[model samples]
Target chain A: MKVIKTVNIFLAIAILILSVNLMKPLSITGSSVADLSDAECYFVNSGVSNDIPIDGCCYEVQKQLECKKTSKDYRCYTSESSERYYVVNANALNYCKVGGYDVKII
Target chain B: MSKLSEDMSKDVKLMIVLVVVVIILIFFNFDSYGVSGEAANTDNIQYEESTNTLYLDSLTLKQKIAQMVITYHKETNKERLQDLFIGGIHMGAKTSKEEFMNSIDNFQDGSIIPMFISVDLEGCANPFENFQEFPALNEINTKEEAFKVGYDEGKLLKEMGFSINFAPVVDLDDKIWKCRSFEGSPEEISEKAKYYIDGLQENGIVATSKHYPGKTLMLWDPHKYVVHAPISRNDLMPFEKSIEGEVSAIMVSHIIADGYANSENKPSVVSEKLIGELRNKFTGLIITDEIRMLGLSDYYSDVDQMYIDLFKAENDVILNFDINLDNLEHMISVVEKAVIEGEIKEERIDDSVERILNAKGVNVIR
Candidate 1:
């Protein structure tokens, strides 16, 4: 009876360890958002400032980011940047995360 | 059961537990592990969805970044060279035919793309290497001498496996570049550079016209801090001429051409619109001068982000980002993470690589 009880306890302990191991994630820190689907159009800032850069948009939907941070998910901007947006990746989006902006990858 | 048999069963149970524990450890924390050189770390990062086969798709993200940096070597590190997969390397001044040939051979041999083995043989007396001398550039009074200067320099560089020379400082300021420049008006510099540029390319070498838009005209040295030149597009005509002359690449200076597209007074290295304007005008690769220059140091307060911003600024090759491989790896890692995080597109990398490969005379895979 005691030996059977011991086996059950050991098995229970093993199972418990396995569950915890499975629960321990490698890292759950940053954004887990999938990149924007192919062919999605987005705005790219000609000027950069304190902005997070993003990528992966449908090509057809892409447009110019009229101003610097004024654009969605945009960060860096120059004072001269007016309300005019250039298509994303048109000049290799000059995104700056220096301001600790959580770059939203569109 | 015998005592030995009982002991064996116990050992088997312990072994099973150990195996289970090891397997669990490996499975839960395997994200850090990589199969190749510093690339697997980007497993979680986002990448450009370029479907075209440009020979770049086959490379790991690390190699893609490597393609964008150009470093120099007092002597080459072959394994680290291949490991980093750097695009090009320049040697200081002159090297003997033997040292140059050996390192260049190994570098090209180990590279998947043809390396842009380069040197800066700008003038007659090579101040950096002291290998040989051509007549001083400014002293060359006639057109034939300019070509002769280029041809002689090209012959020596070609024999030594040097494919690129940062020469013909097209900047019109004679005082800043001193003897290194053609020391004349923008028109004169352009006229001289045509023969010089042609002489090098025809001799099977590529020539790079540097200090874009005339930093030489600025009183302050960009090697120190931002020189607010505030020069207009007209001032940069010599660089345009060199570009039109079919020089393979134009090395952009750190000086701010505030008058031209640069409203924020930012160095051209950090300004997209400034570099973009240059890109619009010039069809070939747009290379940055060097990242280690103090002008950059004073330009950005955050060192780490400065490295990231260099790429964001859209320079084809980040010349002298860092020399040490480990330090270079850290720099590369920051870029790798940016790339994976979708701050930049993979096609952005592909574009630079294609330009670099084409400039190096490597047939683009299309």
Candidate 2:
């Protein structure tokens, strides 16, 4: 009886872990989004900001995603250069991400 | 016997559970677990090889118009582009070198005319970002270093089957990326660009000097849809040197210019006054930056009208990277309709197509 009960518990745990893994693909953190208000944006390289030099925080557009956060009204973008995600009001950055690109990020 | 039977049954149940867990893990390993670009249906297209003797008149209006467009390459839309006979394909970032080479070879084999496989291998804005590394332009201090970097980049690009490199950015000031441009005054930058262009061209790779009217890398406020720059005589020097060196192509920027190479407050790419002036100075291919840029697109209210203006502008090659294949097809049809209505002359299309064919090493007999 103990063996059967142990097997059931193990199986349940495995299934629960799998479900959680399948839910979130992107690692968008809920932390405060970076302040990119004064940051200049480009289609290729991350433009220089008053605070950050070009080398310090250059974000080259890796793949433009189709996800548009309607509440903030900004299109999603992914960069191979930086770990942190930015939500900027720049039309150049916003317009560039208006389509399906890298399959990894939608 | 009863004890042995119970043990065997328990083992079998455990084994079954183990197998189930393994199968579940394997299923999730596939890329289908995440969201990706939609798969396009290219079933109806047929691939045909081009003969050596391709003529100017042999191509139809649609094919000629198609030859003027350079669209982004997607794995699913390979056959669709092959069917359209696009002039060129721009590759985004890719990690595996073998896979990249194979994709280039596959597209080339399917095309009737050899396509210009282009990549942004500029020092800072590298498309081969993940697996490859190259010296940034600003890091080089001498002409010899610039030439060697160009030669090496050209050799690798040629080996990988790339024909056009949109590189050797001659922009004088690069405040945005900081490292995208070579360091120096206009004269020094121009000299390095000349040497770089020579090295790249010598290795059978066509070099392009980009963002033509200068100051494209300057920092700006993001609120304005279109930004204008005052281009000076010094700002024009690098492009002038590039022109003197016979660079195969020059990419026009979206900046609205006022001085020396005046774009007349319009994006340089779509300004006839600007392109016409350039045509007089250089006889090589004049390509535009991506037409989808908001700096250019936001200038007009209607998208179709923007397409008409782009063709009317007389750029030899148009870069349109709209992800949707339908919008690309729609742009083609819209241009075709404009040609039929005489909004854009058929002779103008012939002129651009002839230039495109000549660049592709095709002998155009008119």
Highest TM-score against the true fold, candidate: 2
TM-score, cand. 2 vs. native: 0.73
lDDT string, candidate 1, B200-278, tens digits: 8888897888777665434553123456776766567777778788887788777766665472577777777877777
Clash count, one per candidate: 25, 1
Docking class of 2: incorrect
DockQ of 1: 0.02
Q: RMSD of model 2, in Å?
A: 14.7
Candidate 1 positional error at B119, Å: 0.9
Candidate 2 lDDT for residue B136: 80
Q: Write the per-residue lDDT of candidate 2 for residues B1-366, one digit (tens) a residue.
A: 999779768866875786587567647633323112323232332333364456566565667788899877676777778777788987765656787798899888867678889887876645554556677888878888889889988988999999899898888977755677999888899999988888898888889998888888774445664778999999899999999988999999888999888888788888989998998888889999877655676576666787788889888999876666656766776788789889999898889888887777776766
Best by lDDT: 2
True contacts kept of 2: 0.07
DockQ of each: 0.02, 0.08
